[model samples]
Target: MISQSAGKIFLAEERGHNELNWFRSFNTFNFGSFYNEHKHPFESLYILNEDTLAGNRKISMLAENDSCIVLIPVVGAISFKDSAGNSGLLQAGQAQVLNVYAGTTLEISNPYEEESVNFLQIWIKTPDLQSTVPQLFEFDLDKNPNQLLELFSPQKKTLVKTVPQPHGVIGKFSGRSEAVYNPAQSGNALFAYVIEGNVEVQYRLMNPRDGLGLWDLEEMELEALSENAIVLILEIPVLKTV
Candidate 1:
């Protein structure tokens, strides 16, 4: 049995909120002015921000060196353009990853006329920068229900492999459905986020927007508590503190 000491739960309500006239964001870690010493980067998983943009609204962010940025649209399509001359639209069922250098300005905007768009922006620190272009992965949850669908894997040639690669998966399960996840690499950590419905991970209940981090375990079990429950799991390598 995996001990409870290997898990840490982060409640949704405890997240930092930044609201403006056209943009609203809930940060799970230190981002912008929302700094929490207790909420530091979970291993190499640096940032996880849930952002909502009003119609025709836009926001810009500067990229850090030796980092990878991943964007997942949750509600509506979002248009993005980076200073490196890359631009595209990310739909609800799609995920995009881009290895960016320092000082790259990324502009993300809601393309809808009257509807708001919600998306998740995740940042991961890499050992070194790689010369790779932006890549998009699309998956349909309805196509394969009650199973984990892999969204991103480090095995791709486009991804940097200077260090242990991170893997990402998304799953949709019905009530009473059960699933298990085993990390591809040893000594890696797992971070699970509830996207739509409630779920129980390793005996801990989690609501929508809640996140749970676990380490020092070989595998973890998950069970959906509601219909059409969606969860995002990231297998991140444990990095040593410098």
Candidate 2:
């Protein structure tokens, strides 16, 4: 068990947005060329990048070590092939998790020639920084609307197969309603990202693609302010050393 206190909020507009010829990315925490020492990883919760790619455009693959990366498609689809000879397609209703140890390279591309695809890529740091063999897991998002659905739970091996766990809980909230979040791990922090429509966290309004990070609280209230609003919430440790 960890110490719990009042939670703080990190606004979305304060983040960095970078637009390029092939990709447009928004960084919730310092990433790529948008570096901010203060806005670095939130405890073990490292990176959250919202990206949009032009159809048929390929973003050069990623080479990382000892990191758990999750990709969720929002608007379209993406085709990916990893150095480990794993390949798959991620659509709007699906999500993918990549566990990289030691080191691995991954290539992602938009398959459709006329439609653009938008996705979110999140990185969570593990306790042990040592590298391991790369593995990929893709799962379909729960279709439950107007409620919170657990997408990934670190202790639940049946959810996804990987090491280190990250010791976090990731969920998807759909429809317009109020939901209470109780961290599976006491003293953990919460990071909520609005996928579509509007949502309010602790009385603070968040629009599409907006994000808020809360910590030190036993529970937090989340309200979907508009129809079809979708929010992704991640509960991670508040201590940086975790």
Candidate 3:
């Protein structure tokens, strides 16, 4: 059984870090060689990695079957090409969702000449795919400051038939601004990550790169402690199996 505590905070410094010649990754959960018995998968959300790729360098990974991968560029744009014949450049203001099959090689590269690129890679266990195409969503958090901007939601009719879909949103808020988030479904878990600046979630203070997981709650509260605070929220359903 999962913990029924009010919440669990994963501190930024506690994340597992991996450094390579061309890549540096910080894993929020067990991934690659970064495994922690306490840092287990949060419900259906399996992987949350903050990765930095060196300029002109690339890395490839095999996609997992029956899963969804989400990419969000943080510091710079990233160019990606997959064996499935899908390719694109994902900018900072956009999010990409890919419905991948097993054995598909996905290569992500930094397009800049001398600057490194930072991005987030999230993996969620999903239902079998009905379509293999990728989807891109563009959002301007600066234009709609202090409000949550939806990035990807499985509830969309256009989404491939992946049941029990996770909902993702990003928001930029001003200092002292407060917001309330209601889960789309009861029993769903909420994972909040502070992308920049300070914030308080459910009364727990969080710094940049910190993550908080809350479950068995109908609503969660957030308050930005600094100007231009950016946050990412994921409402994930708890699956029967890991």
Candidate 4:
């Protein structure tokens, strides 16, 4: 029998380092001062951050000209103002995608005066790094309650199908549900993060904020272990591009 720790990447609750007063971030891979050369990035997926910002406080992040960024609010709301003049408000169940070509800077702050906000910041290096055009997208996930919904993809195709390219996929799983996740290609990778509640991913249980990265598999089965359980999955290419 394969142990729960075997052939799987299990990032426990305390493995992520915390920042100072304004931001508390957990690095799925080496990020910021949390440097681990061996843990720099996974394929095309570079950064995965679980961040909490104090009310009225803000944080700034720089994106390379050709990389892509996706932000999902988990608790409270955040107001994002970027160098491209793309500013908007996003609350829980809402997501924002930024195609940061030609270099971009983003400032994110908690809009509420008394409420702190927690959100996930993910970065993926795309094949279109030389493109100078930048685009921003915002969408809500309230349409589907218990099923896995695709929030963003390279081709912007339907929920289950993604273009077989060096791309990234964002999915949200809600309620006590079960689903099979098939990668866009045979040797791709999938990284799952439990946003809220508990879930048994491929027979291993994961709690809130726990992250698991799986590869070398044909398919994955996800079962929500609790009511209203919500998880986020990121699918990416097995090879990182320029």
Candidate 5:
């Protein structure tokens, strides 16, 4: 078994508001610019943006080969429009995955006459999608199994059809997550960022306004000891090199 750290602990901080008038809410720090150069190809397992859109306002469809995308809502509910002309509403505890194959436009809107919606957008690297179609899996609070949430996955097709096992799951632990990584999970890397509460990771404790760096490792764990402790964990598959 490959033994190593679970990686480090860090916190997710709010950046600012987005430029879109229709897309309201706090634009998170991880919301990277299109112009910004990326260091590791899929290393940037996530590009986040907490969005709050106005009624009837529409967001442009966005996609990048650089990553697989997932959306999580903190408050309010949002609907999406895809190239397949598919549309649906995603509520709190609801996770949406974006498959940007050959690029598709995604229009996000909140049309409820009473409430405004807030959500978080997360991007990760896509696994090999050869001869497979894009996928989506949803978990609702009423039926959600654990304290965690599985919002999206691009590898679901390959995992379900071939291995009978799924790659990894990104869960939001309100206070603290049982930071547990499996050894059987071969060819993967771990990333965790605190969005709400503080977490003690190994000997390193992290609070708001901090970020932990990671690379090839074995296993990592996280613990949040207080109320409202929110953490976003990204399990990115390490790309095999030649």
Candidate 6:
């Protein structure tokens, strides 16, 4: 049985950095400053790191073809050139997802040439996909039409679904509507993690990084105004086999 802490935050850190093996790297945890702490992973715990790179610097001989890698820019534009001679630039409003299985090399640099670039890189076990070419999908905060981003199960086209069916849904909320979530099924477990700002959720005060877990509830309410509250929501099936 998964512990109640399963939906809890095991780690949380602000923007920070350090150097390793002659390579300067940024990470969410100060522990990364020590080389030995750089390697750690669990069955469900994949790779999670927020990184920033200086101009013309190279770290981690990352291949373009690695099971599954996603790069999301939070600040400056990140310049990238892959093994297949593929090149592109990712900015704050963009995210690049690659499935590197056919052999691909990647070289990322500061897009500004003089300034640095920062982004979040998460590596999860790719679902059983026989053939998945690197796919790039640009997301603009304005594209939501209502300023909302939709992430569903990669297994399903809509509704948040994880590759492993993830057992839950995870996302952020940053608006007035609160992204009404209603699970049509029972035994669904859900929770929300505040990333930044505050929100008057269900009349309760939620500050940055604060999280609340909920289960056995079919519907929950969220509303925010005055401040753009950023929240990470996770929904899971309490009992199911995938």
lDDT of 3 by residue, 31-68 (tens): 88887888998887888999999999998878665678
Q: 1-242, model 2: which lDDT tens digit per residue?
A: 53434544456777778998878988888877888766877776777888899989977546554566677788889988767676788887666666665366777899999788998888776645433433444444455666666655543432333223443333345555788877666656788778778888767788987777776767767888787777778876555452
Q: How close is candidate 1 to the true structure, as a TM-score?
A: 0.94
Report lDDT (CA) for all predictions. 0.87, 0.69, 0.86, 0.70, 0.54, 0.50
**lDDT score of residue 40 within candidate 2:** 74
lDDT of 4 by residue, 1-242 (tens): 85442244546554558689777888878876777555657777878888889988999988863567788888888899888778888877667777675467999999988788888888887654433333344444455666666566553332233333333333455556787777666666787878778888888889987777777777777898787777777776666345
Q: Write the per-residue lDDT of candidate 5 for residues 110-148, one digit (tens) a residue.
A: 768656677766655455544224455656543442245
Write out the backbone clash pairs for model 3.
none
Model 6 over residues 1-242: C-alpha lDDT tens digits?
52232323233343245654333554332234433343233232244455667766655435322345566776787777766555677777666665555355667777565577666665444334333445565555434432335332232342343323222223344466465666544555655545556654444566654545565666656665535555544443343347
Candidate 6: clashing pairs of residues: 64-104, 65-100, 66-100, 152-160, 152-161, 153-160, 153-161, 168-235, 168-236, 169-235
Judged by TM-score relative to the true structure, which candidate is superior, 1 or 5?
Answer: 1
Q: Which order, best to worst by lDDT? A: 1, 3, 4, 2, 5, 6
Instruction: Report how far residue 62 has shifted in candidate 3, in Å.
Output: 1.7
Q: Write down the worst ten-residue block by lDDT for model 3.
A: 155-164
- In each prediction, how many residue pairs overlap at the backbone (N, C-alpha, C within less than 3 A)? 0, 4, 0, 2, 12, 10
Candidate 6's TM-score reads: 0.60
Clashing residue pairs in candidate 2, if any? Answer: 5-216, 101-132, 102-131, 102-132
Candidate 4 shows a clash count of 2
| Per-residue accuracy of model 1 over 1-242 as CA lDDT, tens digit each | 74574777778898989999889999988888898777888888988999999999899998775667889999999999998888899999999887777788989999999999999998888665555577788899999999999887763563444457777999999999999998877777999999999999988999999999999878889999999999999988778776
Q: Tell me the deviation in Å of residue 64 in model 5.
A: 3.0
- Highest-lDDT candidate: 1
- Residue 201 local lDDT, model 5: 47
The true-versus-predicted C-alpha distance at residue 80 of model 2, in Å, is 1.6
